[model samples]
Target: MKPRTLVIGDIHGGLKALKQVLARAEVTAQDTLIFLGDYVDGWGESAQVIQFLIELEQKQTCIFIKGNHDLWCEDWLKEHILDKTWLFHGGQSTLKSYESLNDAEHALHLNFFERMRLYYVDEQNRLFVHAGFTSMHGPAQEFHQSNFKWDRTLWEMALTMHKHITKDSKLYPKRLLLFKEIFIGHTPTLNYDVTIPMNGCNVWNVDTGAAFTGSLTIMDIDTKEFWQSDTLVSLYPNEKGRNR
Candidate 1:
């Protein structure tokens, strides 16, 4: 049997939830795991989460995409400057997680973050992006850095586009037809009023809002089968989440 390509949504430092989602998904050595980023911030345990991922890489294939939060983290690690925006959006918890690490350990974590990708395209033309592509030229065109980690217009377009239009209703946008499937995570599924993964046009949103009150999601790229953890609030019963 072929190993499944499992694409996971934003983790947001929810280590317990991340563990449960992986366990429920029955992840194994043969499976390929693609993390959608925002690995730090929100809940506590950001350091431990990165450590766990580093260890997991020794056993299975894993791909880490860079999200907006992850980019902030990289900036902090590389420049040694605190970003006010990152701080306002759960950066404190991430900083707390790294406070105890020694120089070597800190370097290891930084290296991992530095190696993350902006976007990944598979052989079949499927695109996996942290947020979404922003090229007016479409998916085949290289995207700007902001588009890969911070673009919300793609999701907005996907959500609001008309399913059917008159023949003369202006040229249908080419963005929706650029890829066989585009998987993303920055936009939480709950925003769409659904807790589970929601498919719009050819885009699939897997971020079930692990940073807030939502659950963590893990889905099979081909099968579309998914498993999710309990509500994030339940994962850290004793503490309030970052944005909660």
Candidate 2:
């Protein structure tokens, strides 16, 4: 029997790079294509990025987790976030992707970004998250909106102080938070290789910062193989400090 596996990680709104990574994975019906999120707000083609995932959703088992960037897209559509700020941060190209749409059509475009999940996991020995968990076996509840979605302070604390637990976190406090590898995005790798803790919570980060100088990457879970696409030229540089 062919081994079943899952491929996932951050896309950061680059449709072309996403496609190339899928091609490299040689995705098959037996395999699942999962995304860790950040569906919009970087590179060109937010509409195209959403459309691509939507189409893929039809033929394969896909799970789209929401990321901070995605939340910004939803906020932008609702005008909850200022357009100039949104567009300034790699969102201009995303806006351009839907420039031709009428109001009704635009609402449809808006819907995609609005509906997304925050986390996903299973007994299959895998879990996925946009950033990282709260603390050493920190409650998954810490990832709840009240924790990171709406509270910047908590989010920053998690980011600045959190460490990938090698053994257990509150989220998996009792079960040992097991994973031969936990694949993730949100944090750009120092170079190109995925960072894994020497003892536990081995991480495979495929987000090669495709929205900037990084390559779009995806990994084959069962084979320990990875596929990457070259950097798409940055349309919005100096979005600075904030992650894509």
Return the top candidate by lDDT: 1
lDDT, residue 213, model 1: 86
lDDT of 2 by residue, 43-123 (tens): 656777887787777787787777777776777777747567666766776667777767876677577666676666756
Candidate 2 C-alpha RMSD relative to the actual structure: 5.3
lDDT of 1 by residue, 1-244 (tens): 5799999999998999999999999889999999988999989888889999999999999999989998888888888879998999999999998999998998898999999998888888888998987776765475467888888888888777646542234665577667788899999887767899988777889999888889999999999999999998998987666664
Candidate 1 at residue 214, lDDT?
93
Q: What is the lDDT of residue 99 in candidate 2?
A: 76
Instruction: Flag regions of model 2 displaced more than 4 Å.
Output: 1-3, 83-85, 135-139, 143-181, 190-200, 234-244
Compute each candidate's TM-score over C-alphas: 0.94, 0.74
Error of 1 at 161 (Å): 2.1
- Lowest lDDT sum, 10 consecutive residues, model 2, at 146-155
Name every residue pair that clashes in candidate 2: 136-169, 137-169, 137-170, 138-169, 138-170, 138-171, 166-200
lDDT of each: 0.87, 0.60
